[model samples]
Each structure stands twice: as structure tokens, then as C-alpha cells.
Target: MKLKLCVSNTDVLLSTLSAIQPLRKLCVLRFTPVHLCIISMALNEPQAWCKISQEVFPLYEVESIRDNVLCVETNIDPLINALRNFDKSNSDGLSIRLQRRPVANEGPESSKKNRSMAVLSLIYTEHVSMASSRSYSFKIPVKVLKAEIDQGIVEPQLTHAEVLMKLDRDILPLFRRIERYKRSGYICVTGTNRGRLELSIEEDSRKVQLSWKEFLQVQQLEGETQQQSQFSTQDQDMPHSVQIKLKDWRLGAKLTELCYKVVMIISENHALVLHCILNEDETAEVTYYIGGKIQDQE
Candidate 1:
């Protein structure tokens, strides 16, 4: 159902997975209408926490950790029901204290003192009305926290802005013309203003050159599929017009695992073309671009 986990210490975020791995596996195999929520409390502001929620239903693959954000995919309705049930249950303070303290599980037994820690305070809800009636909560203690931390388990730091900036400056600049075309939204030939020119890219050599008008006309006569989508449509739709030019363009690079799609416009060479860099959907963590046409260089 609905699970709420709060971490007070900022550094604990790293080992979150390993620390909860045991519990997660158990819950995954057992819980119904799976929905999970995580809240990270501010170190300075003890009362404030960043909360994220997701549904975990029909026990599937173990989702990997990335960008300090945990993602879980499952059906929505069941998770919603679980959340409802969580709210139904009421409580003043979480209940997680040992009756007579068990022996220290690690190191010397008497040397260690057992301290109470709240790993997570979970709640489950059923229907919008009756859901709140069947809820439960659990708080993990400090001993478990220490064990997880010592194991060095967690996700890497999130430097999305820095990563994107580096990609634009270093990687995209190598194929300045191609990047420009991708942003502009089309592939056009230089020096042909009235008639459309055919363009082709060499896969092996990575070279590019304009095709003859006759060649394109022949293809057209042969009923070959031609790009009917006008590039001007994109330019006209842009809030502002910024033209980019290219010289002897070629497919310089292919991007994979990109979270966002970006469009750029280049200036000076005297033609406008739009190009797209493939985002394989694995590497990128954030959506970089949302709009279709870009307006003037920043």
C-alpha cells in the first residue's frame, strides 16, 4: 500500500538501498496494492523533508537507483488504494521499541548499547473511505542504519546541470554544423534557394555532400518517398526566427541514453537545418528540452 520513509541524516541517502534492501525484498513479495513514498528530512530543518511517491505492484524487476531518485513502476489504482488506507490509520507517535533489548548482533555484545532508530514509518490505506482502517507503521533503529552505512550502499551524486553543460560545450561543438541543423529542425543544401537539393551522408567515411537536382528529380519520378514535411513550418512556428547555416554536413555523432531532446540553431553559414540527437533513454536522468523549435541563440 502506502509507505513513508524518512531519513534525518543527509549522508544516509547514499546507503538507502542497501539499508532497506532486506525490507524491500520482503515487502515486494508480500505487500498488496504496492505504493511507496520516501521523504528526506532536512538536516537543519528537522520537520521538513522532500517526499517522493511511486507505485509498486505485481512484484517485478528490481529498479536500479539513479540521480538520488528512486523509480518504481506499477499499476496506479492499487497503489492509490494503498495510499488511502495509509491515511485511514491514525497515530500520535510511531511504535518501534524493543521490550527487553536483544543481544548486540555485532562486535562485542556488552560493549554496544542498542539505540532506537526509525528507518521508515509506513502506512497503508484501502478504499477512499474504508482504506484508512487497515494501516501499519514501522520505525527502524540506529543500529540498522550503522550496518547499512558501513556497507557503502547508495546512488552516486546528482550533477545533472554540470553533465549537460559539459555535453553541450565539449561533445556538441565538435560537429558544430550538425548540431545547428538539429536545432533548426531540417537538412537543407547550401546555395540552393529556389529548388530543394538532395542530401546524403556516407556511413563508413562519415562524409557528406549535396546531391544533384537531376538525381533528386529522378528519385521523385520513381515514386521514392520524399520528405513532404516542410522545414519552414517549424521556423514559422518558432516564437522568434534564428537562422543557422552549415557546410558539408555529416552525421558526426549519435547520442544514446539521453533523458531529454534538445534543439539548437547555428548562425553564419547561410542555411537553416534541424537535427536530432538520439537519446537512448538510459543515461539521461532529466529531460533537457521540451519545446520543438528553439528561438535565437542564448
Candidate 2:
């Protein structure tokens, strides 16, 4: 398996990794002929999923016999730290190459048990002068998946949500309010298809509610999205409510800072999706999927 990638505009990658870095978990790097996807899937933590097209990168190549795709999971902090310290102007372009480290802690067996075994080396070529140039490499350790054994992942499929709204306000303050409730382990969100939303949490004898009267609705495709008349359709007008983990909700809030627009999708009491869009062209996006709190979990 061989995979190499180079991007002229590192802003997309930098911003995306920076946003999701707060999750502090290993992220999956999926390299295909078409695009690259960075994902972090966890049961108790917020799941972050995003896609970046090959067109976004001037150089993208992947070679593999099975499925013609390569998937590796690794910690993103090193890469983020390297980019943070690197001078963007001096960067000719960032080149990535996959390499196998002798001892991997990915699976069951390892020497130290905590060290990463595989890596995607980050190579930066810097031109010092007219004819002088310098090169630096940082090995961002990864866990390469075995194509024959591991089933690749796909984006989660959700039933059409009852309400999807375009939120324009910052959500940081809302999360701050929820933080004060020591007894509130979860946050209850109620909303209508017509753009009304309510977020609240309860602490022992106290209750705090934050409401928004109106907001822009998400544009839908012919079958995907349309109008849900609040007046005519009784069910459409009825608000859908779901309780999500306060911790995950707060993590979702961090995504808003990385996006140009924020969209919330609710599915009654089943699940919630926080769609964070980074660009208008849809070249890059980071979305968080939060499952509703189950009774037994409480």
C-alpha cells in the first residue's frame, strides 16, 4: 500500500484538525482516489466526520490492490503542532507519505503497548535562498487498517429529521449557562420545523431556558427537504425534543468556531446532528453526531 498527498492551501486541513483537536482522540484518515476523510468515532464521545475532495489538493494519490483505498487511524496533535509552528509562506507545499513503523501498538501486541506503529510522514520542503533548500520530516504515527480484515466505514445514515435550522448565533454562551448546572447531566433541546428552538437544563429545584423565536431554515432538495407547515400540519408544528449528553453538546459547541455556518438537525428523541460547514463551496465540513440519552444510561 502506498499513499501520498500534497496540498497547496493548508488552511482547510489546519482549520479542520484544529477544530476537532479538542476531542483529544485518534482520528481516522481515509485516502481514496476521489477524496480524503478524517473521522473520529467514539461511543461515549462526540463523533466528528468530515470530507475533503481530491480537487481541494493539487496532489493526491493512493495505491492499493484492495478497493483502491487506504485507511489509517492516528493522533492528529503532532500534525497540528507542526503546522502551528511552521511558516506558511516558506512552505513549498506539505507532502505526506505512509510508512510502516516496526513495532505498532495498534492491535493486541506491542512492546511498550502505548506507542503507535504506523505513520504518515509529513515532509516540508523549504527554499532557504535562490539555490538553497531545506527539508524537514515529522512522522505522525498511525494505525494502518488491513483491507481484507477490517470493514471500511461510511457516513452515518439518519432518518429525515423533523427540524433542521440554520443557526447564526454563537453557541458558546449557551454552553456556559449549562455548565452551571451541576445536577444536569444532559441538556434537553426542543424545536419545531418552523425554526423555533429551546435549550434548557435543570439543576435540582432550578430550571433555565434559552429560546430563539425564529431562524433561517435549511434549504432542502426535492425529496430531502421541503416545507413543514407549522400551522397546517399538526405533527410538523409539534415540537420534537431530545436529551443529549451535556459533555458531547459542549464539544459540539467547539465546532461552531471552525465553521462559517451552523445547522442543527433533530430527530425527535433518537439523535442529533450538528452540521458545521467551513466553506460555501462544500469543500470541507465537520459534523458532530450525538445520540440521545437513553434511560438506562442515566
Candidate 3:
């Protein structure tokens, strides 16, 4: 099996991966004709599922023995370290290739147990200086598991949230303040049809609420007309809110450095979803879902 792709903006892609590095140690990278996706799942309570996407890369040439899609599991730290050499400004382009290689055996008796190994190679180059090019490769082992294991984890339906709105300013500062006070807390989000939204953190004695008036207009998701109408009638008095862990909410803060705008969805005690756009064209998006603390109320 062989797969190769050329990346136009290495900085954007690397920054995207850096955001996911803290979520989990192991990341499952998937490549298809359409997009390159990275999926990571955190352990224990208040678990999170993050998917980072690059819709249109420079290239997506694949040659596989089995199927068109290729999946590989690799350590996130090593991959991130390998990509640190690429300068965001000077780097011309990046190329990634996945292929199968034979595992080397030092002992003579080990030859009998020889097996094929999966290798991921990353090549970074500078168009101006041919001598500045460098290549880094890593052996990313693969495990055999049921294909249905990730059925419901990777791409979840976003039908849970009724109120959706886009924030005007960067939220990293707010998240930084929240992280200092509490590691985990609920994100009480309330929105109105008049394009006003408020995010608050109320835990114990600490209470902080950040409100934005006349931000971007409220966005009505598909089939959300009824909910929008309800919000309009109630004005800003009745706002849909969700309880989410502060730690999980902070996971998406790194995206603020790359994403210009953030779209937030509140499911009212079910879940909180954040869609971050990585590129100006809106072709690439990174979505994060944090399950709410209170699950019963809808």
C-alpha cells in the first residue's frame, strides 16, 4: 500500500495537529480522496472526540492493496516533533507518504518472524533553496481491530444543539481565565435571535460571564427555524444553555490561533459543539464535541 499527499500550508496543518496533541496520545489518521482527517478520543469522564479536517490538500494520490481509504494509528508526540522543523514562513511545501516496509531483524533466528511494518514519511522542502529540504520518517505501527469500533465516535450527528451562534472575538483569553480558576466547569451558553450571545462560568463562588451584543447575526442551522422563532419571541430573556466541563472546553482554545472565527452550538444540558475554521476559504474545519455535565434535561 502507498499513499502520498502534498500540503500547501504546513503551518496551518501542523497547528491543527498541535491542538489535538493534548486530547490523546494515539491518533488515528485517515486518508481518502476527499479529505485527510485526524481523530482522537480522550479517556475517562467528560470524554471528548475531536476531528480535524483538511478538505483539499495539494494532492491525495493513493495506491492500496485493499481499499481506497487508509487508516493508521501513530503516536502524536513523535509526529508533532518531526514537523517542528518546518518554518511557517520559509517552508515552501510539505509532502506525506505512507507505505509498507519490512521490519529489520538483528538476530539470525528473528528472520523467521519477519513481518511487514507501516511507515509514515514526511518531507519538507523550500522552493528557493534546494539545499534546505529535509525529510523525516517514522514507523507507525498498526493494529487489527473491528472496523465498527469507531462507528459512532468519529463523525457524530450535530442535531443535538438548537441554538447556534458565531462569536465575534477570540475566545482563548476567556478560556485561559476559566482554566485558571477551575479545571472543569459548565459552560452556560445563552443566545438570542437578535445576534446576542453570552457565555458564563458559574461554579461555587466563582462567577464570570462574557457577553457579546450585536455580534455576527444568529445562524439558523438546518431545521432550526422553529427554534429560532421561539428564541425571537422570547427575546434575550430565554436562552438555551448547556453544562460542559471547563477542561473539555479548553481543549479547543488552541484553535483560536489558527481559526479566525468560531461557531458555537449549545444543546441545553446535552452537549456543546465548537466548529473552528482553519482556512480563510472555509474549506478546512476542526470540530470539537464536549458532552454536557447534565444529560437528562433537553
Candidate 4:
């Protein structure tokens, strides 16, 4: 299998991955002719799932072994370390390729190892060279696991009561402020007929609420409009809140510096979904799913 893609904005891609690096240790990378996706799932309960996507990476060229799909599992740190070396300013362009290295025969009398090493070749050119362009490459060894990979992309199912809203401002600042109060907090989100949205956090006896009176845009998913219509008069005006671990919410904040916009979906008492747009064109995006915290009974 051969796969290569020329990255248009290396910084954006690297930053997105770095933001997700803390989510899990191992990441599953799936490559197709049209897109490249990085997926991670937390092993423990209150599990977190993230999927980062890059559509047309300036250039996309691929030759797959099985039905045009290639999946590999690799350590996240090493890949991030290798990619951080890229000098976005002086670099012309970056291209990544998947290759296999043949096992070397140790001796004439000994048989060669049957296993081949899978490597990711990252090649970038330095435009600083005057007479001749200098090219540097790093070959990172990645493990090709025998485990079956999911070919289709899947997101956590949302209930009818879920409210999805687009934020006009960056959420990092708000998240940072809440971090000082506690390690986790409940997010109470409310929408009004006047197109205003409010996000609040309550702790101890203090309640902090931030409002965007004219800055929010409500997004209607496939059946969301019909669902909203079913809401009773009081339910439509009441706040929809979900409890989330601050640690997990911080992960979404890390992407704020790299992503241009953040869209949040809160399922009252169920889950919090964050969809981050990484580029101006909105072609690149990352979605995060964090299960909500359950409140204690009164």
C-alpha cells in the first residue's frame, strides 16, 4: 500500500493533533483516497472519543491494498514530536508517505525475519537554500496491528432533547475561568427566541454565567427542528444543562488556539459534543465526545 499527501498548512494539522495528544496514548490513523482521519478512544469509563479530519490536504494521492483503505495504530507522542520539527515559515511543503521496510538477512546461513516494518516517511523541503533546495525527511516507525479497523466514521448518538449551538467567540477563555473553580463543572446552556445563548457554571455558592445576546447561531440537525417543536412552552425557554469533567473540557479548549470556530451540542443530562473547525475554509475539523456527569439525587 502506498499513500502520500502534500500538506498545505502544516501548522494547522500539527496543532490539531497536539491538542488531541492528551486524550489518549494510542491513535488509529485511517487513510483513504479522499481524506485522512485520526481517531482516539479513552480506555477507561467516562470514555472520551475524538476524530480529526483533513479533507484535501493541498494534495492527496493514494494506492491502497484493500478496497482503498489503510489503517495503522501508532504512538501519538513520537509522531507529534517528529512533526513539530517542521518549520512552517521556511518550509516549502510537507508530504507524508506510508512504506514497508524489508527485514534484513542477518547472515548467509540464517533466515531473514518474516515481519516487515511499517514506516511513515515525512519529507519537507527547506527553501532557505539559495543554490540548491535542501530536503529533510524523517521516517517514523508505525505498528500495523492485526486487529480489525472500523472503515466507517461514527459519532455518539444524540437524543431529541439535545441543543446544538455555534459560538461566536472562542470558548478557551470561558473554560479557563471555570477551571479555577473546580476540576469539573456543570454546563448550563440556554437559548431564547431572540437568538441569544447563555453558558453558565455553578460551584459552591457562586454561579458564573456568560451571555452572548446576539452572537449565537442555532444549528438544526436532520430531525432537530421537529424535536424542538415537540418541546413544551416551559421546556423551550428553560436552560438545558449537562455536567462534564473540566479535564475533558480543557481538551477542547486546547484546540481553540488552532481552530477558528467551536460548535457545542449539549444533551441536557446526557453528553457534550464539541465540533471544532480548524481552518478558515472549514475543510478541516475535529469532533470531541465527552460523556456527561450524573448529578446526585436530592
Candidate 5:
């Protein structure tokens, strides 16, 4: 299903959002003819933005779309650090804001208390439904739908309110299940040499601070020596070219067992609690402690 949305002006919205350092948040869009407000995550990317449109518009033909701005949905947080100068590297470019409204109060009410501001609006058509039952304010554009695809209209909007409701309904139980699973000895424990372990942990952080090759190398090393055994002759020869079908990864390289003492084996997800103890003979034993998620088997 396609999601529907309305914006004040695409150009101004993108331009203003590009200027901000942290480019993630619900945007308040204002326009003539109609004014609507929307969250920033919904309009951050084309796929996401496209998903919200109920009717797709053909941009080349529609002259009125010039002032329409599409913002993100109300919940997805923006990546402050991810904001960089706009680059047309991808088919759609870096996610930029539509137009933004200052978070200030209005007249007497503004001075007394806080009021939520309008971020963006959708262009409505006669066919669009505005009933609050399940209907939304954002309408779809026709220009964005001029391609060959199934279900051209907007998909259901993953609203902030909906996400919160889902979190409370489904995700919270799943989190509790995870906790119970960890307590049941389902998780695995693993670590590399001190420096290597630190590097591996750093690589997993969402900071985009490492080069692609560097990240892959650390992941490979940590994965290979997870079991506390000496590297096989094959592993010693080409550590990078080893082939091991471990869970989700197809090992890219062979491993060289240079250091055995600090090399610990573990499941990637449950590494915090379960430990794999391997002897020099390649035989192994797994020990589980409390607190972590279980690892999925390959």
C-alpha cells in the first residue's frame, strides 16, 4: 500500500531542512490553498514518502506541486550526525526537511502555555477521506505514481501514535521474552583479544565511524577465533578467505589462530551471557549465564 502525505513546498522544505545540522524530526509545513502538518520521518526518503501517498501525482505535469512539502511521519527520529551537505549520490538524495516552523508560542496562549505547531500539509482531492476513523490528512500525489508498480496509492502510515501503541502492545512482550530467553541460557558469549574486542564493539555502534574494509576485517577476526581453539592449518594459511557457515554470515576468509588464550567463542546476539570453551583438540563446550538474548542457529 502507498502512504499519502501533503507538504507546503518541496523545494523550500528540502532547502530549509538541508540547512539544519540535525536533520530528523516532524516538520511543520505551511502553504497556500491548504496547510497541513506532518512528521519528518515520513518524508525523509522517497520509499518512505511514497508509502504514505494514497494517490500518486505526476510531478512533470503538475504545476501546483511546486509549493507542496512532504515531511516525515511523527515518530521516526532524525539522525543528527547523519546530516551532511546534500549529495545526489543516491537516486533520491540525502533526506532533507521540507519546511520548518519555529517552536515558539503564539499570542496570549503562547505566553501562557505551549502549543504544538503545524509541520506540513497534504493536498486533498474529492476522493480523499478526512474522517478520523482511519482516514489521514495527508493526500497522495499523482506525479510520484507515474511508474509501473503494484498498488500505486500510499501505504498505511506508521504514525507515531501507532508506533507507540504497537510498542506497548507487541514490542514490550517481545522484550520480556528476550529477557526470559536470556535467563534460560539461550544466549552465547564470545570475545576477541582485548584490543580486538574493543574494536569489534566499536564497529557495532551506529556511529559510521569506521571505513567499510576496516569494519569487515574486525568482524571477521572476532568471528573466526570465537571458539578458544588453535587455528587449523587452513585457517593459518588464509584467514580472510575462510568459509564457515556461522548463523547468518558466509565467512569471507580463512582464520589464522595466532592467539588462543584471549580468543573466546560466542553467539553474536547472545554473546554477553553464553561462552564457548574450545580445547586444543577442537572439541568445545558451551556455558550459559543469565542475562542476554539467544542466538539464532544457521
Candidate 6:
């Protein structure tokens, strides 16, 4: 299997991977014929799914064993650092290709047949202002997907919420009040369809509630509104809330740096989905699925 990607827009690709680093350390890098997908580890923390189209890379090629899909597991830090260095190099061209290296094991069935390791070879040309140019290449080891193990990785099947809220772009200001309290580990986020969102945390008798009332716009999911009824009950009138760890919540908050618009889809007591729009056209975006925590109120 052979895979090569020529990154045309370094900024867009950099922002995408940078957004994923907080929540995930190691993620599967999948390259399809038309898209580059990042699948986070199936852990208890927030799971991320980022899809960027091939248009970002003018020359995107993959010759994999199955359906032209190449999946390899690698650390995100090196990839992020490589892109940062790409700027320092004043790179004229940047490309990444997959290479195989043979490993020496003590016990081998045949000397001719040794275990092969997969690596991503990053190659770029650096142009110096002194009318001098140099080339650089580095290898990042990776683990190729084995059969159905990683192929089974899929987006969380979240129960759709009819009400979707377009959060304030500058929400970091609101988070400051709660961030100062080191005693609190979790925050209760409650939102109503009436454009009100309340973030509250309680430790013993001391309580703090920060409300963003009537400042945000709430809407229905594209195909979900039709199924939900417009009835007012004690349950429906109550705000949809989720108790999530502050650390996990910050992961989604970090995405605002790359995304144009930050939307939140909340299924009370179940999960909170952050739909981050990377571009105006919405062709490329990231979906962060954060599961709710069921802890005692005491």
C-alpha cells in the first residue's frame, strides 16, 4: 500500500490537527481517495471525528489494500510540530508519503521474510534567502490498521437533539469565573430553548451560577425538528442540562480557535456534541462527542 499527500494549505490543515490534540494524544490517520479523516481513540474521554476534503491537498493519492483507504495510528504531537516547522522552512513544497522498513527480530521464520514497519516520510524543500535551497526529510513511525480492529471505529451514534444552540464565539470570558475555583472538578451546564444558558457549580454551601440569558440563538436540527412536538410540559419546560468534567469541557472549548462557528447539541444526561465549523461552506468540520457523567449531587 502506498499513500502520498501534498498539502496545499498548511494553515487549514494545521488548525485542524491542533484542535484535536487536547482531547486526544494518539489518533488514527485515515486517508481516503476524497477525504482525510482523524479518528480519536475509543476512550472514556471525548471522542473526535474530523473530516477534511481532498481539495486542501492538490495531489492526494492512496493505493491501499481495501477501497483505497489507508489507516495508520500515530501520535499527534509530531504531526503538529512538523506543520509548525513547515513555516520556519519557508517551504516551497511539502509532501508526506508512507514507507516500509524491515525490523530485525531474534526469531524469524526466514531471513528473507522479516517483519516490516510502517512509517510516514515527510519531505519538504527549504528555500534560503541567500539564493540557497535545501531539502529535509523525516520519518514518523506508525502502526497500520490490522483488519477489522480499526475499521470498526465509527462516530458515536448519539441520540439527536432537536434544539441546537449557537454559542457565543467569545465564550472564554464567561468561563473565567468558574475557572478560578480550583475546588470544583465538574460544572453543570443547563440550557433552555429560550436562548438562556446557565453554568453552575456547587461546593458545599457555596454556589456559583453564570448565566448567558437571551444572548444566544437556539435552533432546531435540520431533520430533527419535524419529529419533536411543540408541547409544554414540566419536563419540556425545564432546561436541558449535563454534568461534565471541567477538563473534558475545555477540550471542546479549545476548538473555537480553529472553528468559525461553535454549535452545541445537548442531550440532557446523555451526551453533549460540539459541532465546530472549520469553514464557511461547512465542507470541512469537526464533531466532538462528550458523554455526560452521572454523579451524585452530594
- TM-score of each candidate? 0.20, 0.83, 0.76, 0.77, 0.20, 0.87
Better by TM-score, candidate 4 or 2: 2
Sort every candidate by TM-score, greatest first.
Answer: 6, 2, 4, 3, 5, 1
For model 4, how does the per-residue alpha-carbon lDDT over 95-202 read when each residue is reduced to its tens digit? 888877544655544333323348788888877657777788878777654324454434456764456777645545655665565623455545543245666677
Writing each residue's lDDT as its tens digit, candidate 5 over 1-298 gives 1123333223333322332213234332221123222222232221111111212112211123333332223322232112221121121222222223344445775643322222322322222244432212222112121222212223333211100000012122322332322112111222222212111111232321111221111224433454433545324322111111222110100001111111223333322211222223322222212222333468
lDDT of candidates 1 onward, in order: 0.26, 0.75, 0.62, 0.65, 0.24, 0.77
Error of 4 at 33 (Å): 2.0
Model 2 lDDT tens row, 1-298: 8887886677788888888887765888888888788988875556788888788888888998877788888888887877765545487688888887755235565543444347778888888898988888888778777664236466777776777878755655655565666578888888775567788887788888887655547543334233544335533455778889887777786677557888888877878898888877778888888888775544
In angstroms, how far off is 242's CA in candidate 3?
0.5
Colliding pairs, model 6: none
Question: Which residue runs does candidate 3 get wrong by more than 4 Å?
Answer: 42-56, 65-67, 86-94, 106-117, 123-138, 142-153, 170-180, 221-237, 295-298
lDDT of 6 by residue, 211-289 (tens): 8745578784545443434554323434778888878776777676568988887888878888888977665788998
Top-scoring candidate (TM-score): 6
Candidate 2 wrong stretches, greater than 4 Å: 87-89, 102-117, 148-152, 169-183, 218-236, 296-298
lDDT of 2: 0.75
Give per-residue CA lDDT, model 3, range 1-298, as digits (tens): 5688777655666766777677777777776556667777554333333334444566768655446666666787867776676554366566777755455545776554433335677777554565564444444455322245534345656556676777645545555555565633566656654456676877676778877544545676556566556556544444677776666766655555557677877776777777777667666667777777756645
Predicted structure 4, TM vs. truth: 0.77
Candidate 5 segments exceeding 4 Å error: 1-105, 108-118, 123-186, 189-232, 235-298
Ranking the candidates on lDDT from highest down gives 6, 2, 4, 3, 1, 5
